[model samples]
Target: MNWKKSLRAAGLVTALTFSLVGCNTEGSYSPQEIIDHALQETKEPLTYYGEYTMDMGEAGGKAQVKEWSKDGKRRIETISENGEHNIAVNNGSQIIMYDVVKNTVHKIDISKDGLDDFPSQRDQLEILFNTVKDTHDVKIAGEEKIAGRDTYKIVAKAKKNDTLIGDIEVWVDKKTWVTLKTITNSAGNKMTTEYTKLDDSAKIDDAQFTIDIPKDAKVEEISVPESESVKLDTVKEQLGEFLMVPEENGLTLDGISLDKGIEDRSEYTFNYSKNGQQNISVTVFKANSNANKVEPVFGEKEMDIRGQKGSVMDENKFRSISWQENGYQYSIFIGNSELTIEDLVTYAKQMTIVK
Candidate 1:
């Protein structure tokens, strides 16, 4: 398989594996108790080698993953589909990724960029637990046998039926709290993953977390650019005189971030917040010549914003509006706020070029 197909399959597996499970009424432990127990058990450092299979509705593949972590250092070795070997190592301060097929290595410094290191299994599980706690109703389904070990089955169903994830089910290893099997449904498509082999008690050396780049491999250094905060009056000085902003909205200017876009073009991002909670972002960049010819995604509808033809997409918990004006393409994103489509359209309609 090509790289893009491999990446798509990997993404599908990740989405399905972490999708939240649903609740049952017959288990001995309360849903919250089970989640808390699983969270607490993930704090320990350990090593595991496992073989797993991912089955999407239209695509399927299998891989072997060896993971080890201790004292904030972590490593993962994956033999993905088509026998592609990939290695990632994080030593608390930096991350190095190596691809065996391409014979290339890429390094990023976490400390200098103000970014966190690569996430470990415990971190992922904590995120999953928080997602279940905040958005879904979870229950301990029952017990099951996975990879020769007894496990607890948990299910989580989203309170909102229109979410991308319809429902999820997971079988958690009783002793380690690690997930062994996961099944998820999203938009009428189903995906499942199961661990065929697991060795949690393997002794791993600290050197296992380190990667030595080969002499013949090509090396690339990834740079994380910093954003500059500019005053509203200076926006026209940086961008052009044609950029627009809403003057009457309750949203307050958080900051403006400038980044490099395609072919060295400059992109400007405006950040706004309401009552210190609701966050809204607007991005403006040079519009491609073909931008007007692109087709909208499913469920998006054509609309008129400020007399410019645009598209509006509304999902379960998020909404966005995009349009091309003059020589720029602008997009506005509203995330998980109480704002409705009418509110978003009102905001869009009130936009005026800064004088």
Candidate 2:
């Protein structure tokens, strides 16, 4: 239970408390109703400002965090009791992070929503609730007051197994549909957070996100996704002459996107649909950079893929196989689609390079 690890996940859960306050009705709220409101907030985005304290009991860590988001720009300031402070601002086009005490800045340029991956905070909350809604016992426990607002306490407990996200208890705002507080116990690791101040309707000054770099501050550069979705017909030209893609496909081609490379390098993502869902994707990029190559550990079995050797490994919920050929790297990510290593190897063998 390293609090540092848990602290990384807290920022995401804290997002569940950032929506607008709903009207406080006279009656109580059902677990389903509360969950629906949270899911709905995903579709309707809002501007918000909040400050909260996180106490990781026993694990021994605490921090004061403040958050603000308006339009597509966002900022987060975190301070520890020991006087350590960090401020990061994402203003659509780039991310600027500065260490106040150290006088150092790290900057990364990104397109609007360029680096944001799938399953947004709202989506993650929706998925968490929907996954346990039918499988677990969900009910509103009682009413409580938090952050000066009346809230309904909803608890969801697993029936037989303590696995699926363990048990969750959340205090939702009565007027503002946001979650004011939450306590989650997953496999014996319990985490709690409470918002001390929140204003979803706050008129946050845009200048708050703007940072003026000092003349003598040290600066470092970082890379991020600066690409957009490209049409299939235009992918070849965008890939330049050095890149190639898989020639064979059994599933429907959902779409293709290209990441503008930092150097003379670029990557192409070919997404394929299965059962009306995009379940398979192949990422082709240059193998020259260490960032693009995937090395297999020793004693690990290797597969003869397209006359070249590669290794297939379990990458979280995805089964990925990354190999290099013709000075380029190709990684196929198929959701644990019940595809055995042999099946994966066979698919790779059947692939023909299309220049």
Candidate 3:
């Protein structure tokens, strides 16, 4: 056997192996495949523990946070700038919050709280990738290490019709496909979020979702009044020609509800929203019996709407205009928008009775 020749051959094999491994790590993935992998949610919910820091840029201050999620349940702890601790524990059906600074425990039932299911971070990524995968140009910027794991740097840029949300860059874990960090630069403001520590395999139990309260702490239970989603026809049948929908066709009617309170008066809420960002709630009051009458709030502006006097009030960037007409009390509530009292009055005057 030729010893020198054998050593050279072994070195050549080792170099080839290293080259192939390097190629598989960086150059083997396409941007679309990376997006697809990021979009895929694991069927089995993973047990993980992580600590993260959020920099809100100039819009808000910074915060330190810790999170533990397992088996469709999670516990989150946040520390504010003033050294106050806020902790929230969600066990899928109920939520328990224990304020360390105030020593209070607040319990809320999921069904009775009137809170909608918010999309998770993964879900939001799925939505963005799905919506902009074809419209926006995406590329693999490079690879980097994040939170002690190898990640693929994916960058997607919005092309046209932009606003506060501009271009985005994300670093996703190579193995778990979880987003480890994200950077966004929009409208001259930059926001960044990254997991400073992450552990995908953690020993988490069911007891981790419950919090301990102090002996002298105050406890409060919050529950909303029962409300049902009723159809538009059902509302029109009860009260003929109800004025709920706005004249704006771009905003669609997304939520409709009837709150059966005290069995004598019914409260109807019609929610109109555009892109889930802006909303207008048209709340109509109807009396099942003839004993209830809607009264105008005192000290509000008196405006005319279809020959009826309406009370208008604007406080804390929320505007409400209420008027009694056709045996019903109609109130339009709008918040955080550019619409004014006069604009609402015109809409109210233009409201056609649905027959």
Candidate 4:
């Protein structure tokens, strides 16, 4: 055999072997397929432990270490900030928040019925994920290298003419198909979530979702709305015309009632929900078409609540402006006068009127 001929044959064999290996190991996935796979991987309830820096608008910056666990039925979160650890354990319908600093614990029943909390947590997650999955058009935008890791970028938009969730984008890992980042926009406000140094290796304990209140700490259980005295029938009849319900369950209209109507006066009331949190208010009107700015009988105090900066009024006339802060403008103006801006906030938090 000629040595040169033999060398050429060996080279040919090597090239053929290389080609076979490439074919065997090459990944076959379209961008959309990759995104779908990634989203599926993230569907399972996960527990994550991480450090975060939050930019709270105007309240300044906050640095906290947090642990969050989601099982199909419940969620458990613990946040450490300012040398204090606050633990919140929620099972969809019930929330137990323990404030280490105050050494007090508050429990809120989110459950409509007395059921295990875990299922409630899981159900909420399912609803949120499904909203992102079904209501929007999801697509793989492209591939990019972020922080040295190859990732698939997926963008989402509300199906045509859908005004709710406007747009969203997600980044998925090429190797694991795990979502590395997500961005959501409703109207124009945007929310971005990025996962860094994620470890799927940790085994989450089921007990984390349950909290045992400390014996020495004070335990306070408060109903979300505290139930107001109002005629549900009258509120439905009066305010039903002005109220528009949200398609999303995250926000709801509730507790439409009328307080005692003053002589020659009409009082109306209503309420709304945001992310399972309730706010309500009532309006006592003199039955007069009024000015935009009404004088407060009492003084107004400055305060911030639910991410809104506003004034609080203490007065004889109780008029309310209840608003929902769900990345949109929602407000109800009820009354003929005597309530100040502060009274508006009271209405925002107290009246439960929805048709």
Name the candidate that leads on lDDT: 3
2 versus 4: better TM-score goes to: 2
Tens-place lDDT per residue, model 2, 70-155, is 77577888886778788888887788999999999998877644655433445556656765665579999998998887888989
The collision pairs in model 3 are none
Candidate 4, 355: how far from true, in Å? Answer: 18
Give the poorly placed runs of model 3, Cα more than 4 Å off. 1-27, 111-116, 131-135, 185-189, 224-355
For candidate 1, which ten residues in a row score worst on lDDT?
1-10
Error of 1 at 181 (Å): 2.6
User: Whole-model Cα lDDT per candidate?
Assistant: 0.66, 0.65, 0.66, 0.45
- Superposed model 4: Cα runs more than 4 Å off: 1-65, 68-85, 91-93, 110-138, 143-151, 157-167, 173-179, 185-190, 210-212, 224-355
- Specify the highest-TM-score model's number: 1
How well does candidate 1 match the true structure, expressed as C-alpha RMSD?
5.4
Ranking according to lDDT, highest score first: 3, 1, 2, 4
Compared with the true structure, model 3 gives a TM-score of: 0.58
